[model samples]
Target: MNHQHDHSYKLLFSEPRVVRDLLTGFVKEEWIDRLDLESLEKVSSTFVTDDLRDREGDVIWRVRFGDDWVYVYLLIEFQSTVDPFMALRIMTYVGLLYQELVKQKKLTSNNKLPPVLPIVLYNGERRWNAALNVSSLVQSVPGGLEHYRPDLPYLLLDEGAIVASEQWSIETQNVVSAIFRLEHHRNLQDAIDLIGLLVHWLQAPEQTRLRRHFALWVRRILLPSWVPENEGAEWQPLNDLNEVHNMLSERAKQWPDRWKQEGIEAGRQEGIEAGRQEGIEAGRQEGRRETARNMLERTSMDDQTIADLAELDVEQIRQLRDELQSRP
Candidate 1:
């Protein structure tokens, strides 16, 4: 994946719901059942490490499991290339995390460290061949020192490896898996149905922001090229997920027919090139604007930060803020 795509994945998974869904649905429920999902809290990704090279795409969350708390360390590997030293990398990160916990005085009276569950989320197109345990990387551990080898085993969630036969058991799991499945969708219809599935998952008022963000993703990133710029008249309030699903389904079907008619009309008018250029620019702007708007509504991000994320000017972000406020 490219930087932009990697950044988007980080943004999407940063949400606590996404993290919880991924852990509870994908990972075996034995460990997941021990976790109090409601008590899941995001921990800082940054830790005081002497090596600056440790800074990478990693997300950490703390959750109460019975009487103690456990950390869920998610290593997001976006590069198509496989890292041979992935286990070593995770071992270093987990050590740093344990240090952070100790610094925060989160250990027991006996100085026992909390458990850390390291999970690698690989969305790359290539197959992952990295060693899952640090112990496997030890080249020459003496026979007697075998017990001393660091044996950190991590859970791996390779997006490409996921199949429908291993269906997610919960609503959250289904939506989380569907989001990962979005990039690998075979056709436009599949993508639309996935969006519908996401909508179906949003059952509570607290999920309002998640629903809105998903809508923005579909509008700006997914369907901008296929859907007409002005056909909607205005962004209609989506009160029902089924309604939204039907609307998008219809739009996807209309694209081929619409493109065919537009092609013939462009041949007759000889303004195809100019129209295409204008359409591209218009779509870009609309996508950025919608992205900014969604961030403002769904996140606590400030205008300047949102501007940086959406690649819009600060003034444009401010205008989007005003427009969002003015919405009924």
Candidate 2:
């Protein structure tokens, strides 16, 4: 995982509202209805294991469930690769958390440990194939030894996988859903639209802090990734959600042309690799057509402007536009 991405996610999850919406929107369970989201509070993520080694969690929160507190151990996994032993890791972290609580005398009235809901939020492109329960990682033994095996299971929210499965909707009003949409947006237009929605949804006076966190994430992470380095270097850090939306809306007009130029350059490279004049011409024409198609699908630019930018004939752009309109 990128350090900046990890830190930005931690920043977002630091807000109680983000964590509340995260659980309410994504973690579908009947018990979620009983959670007192208003009672959600951030807790210390640092812990000392029995071995005297220090360990830190990504984010930790505790919320009221009836008369007891349910510890939410949120582990953010942003790497491209999946951790095979993640179940074991969750077991270790939860144990450390229990140990810390015991030392602090934070147990229940019965002097028993509180129940921890271990959750792993993964944003990797690959699907998670790890065991969700620690018992799965341990081999079963005969003579009833299997009864002694650990059975801790953590809830896994695989963002990319969920998006691919289309289980979540982008139209949902939840902040966490909006964040997921922005993270896995199909195109620049999708991101711009979602940012506009975020600006509108977070307009309340009390939501100012959460709004600024989104703005910072967009300014430092999303925009730099979407915009070309030369163009993005000229951009100043956005101060608020409104500024971020305005910046993206204003720069969106220029992106089609930039993408068209990039397509042409990529075509030239492909032609050079093919080492044939016919291949060069074919590659350039196909590139222009593809760029024109992208413009038609991703933007509302007029056919003439798209043709001018893609260096294609207006008739070709019009045909592409018709094809797009005809699609179901």
Candidate 2 clash figure, as a count? 0
lDDT of 1 by residue, 1-328 (tens): 1313444456666677888878877888577786888998987888867756555567888889887888889888767777889999889889888888888999854678988889988877777888999999996567788888888989888787784345644444456788777755645666776777777777688887666666655544444434556765444564344556778787656554444444334443443344686665665566566666555654444678667767779999888888877999
- 128, model 2: CA deviation in Å? 1.1
TM-scores of the candidates in the order shown: 0.67, 0.79
> Candidate 1: how large is its RMSD?
13.1
Q: How far off is residue 148 in model 1, in Å?
A: 4.1
Residue 14 error, candidate 1, Å: 2.8
Give the per-residue Cα lDDT of candidate 1 at 135. 91
The lDDT of each candidate is: 0.70, 0.82
Q: Model 1: which residue pairs collide?
A: none
Off by over 4 Å in 2: 1-5, 50-53, 166-172, 259-328
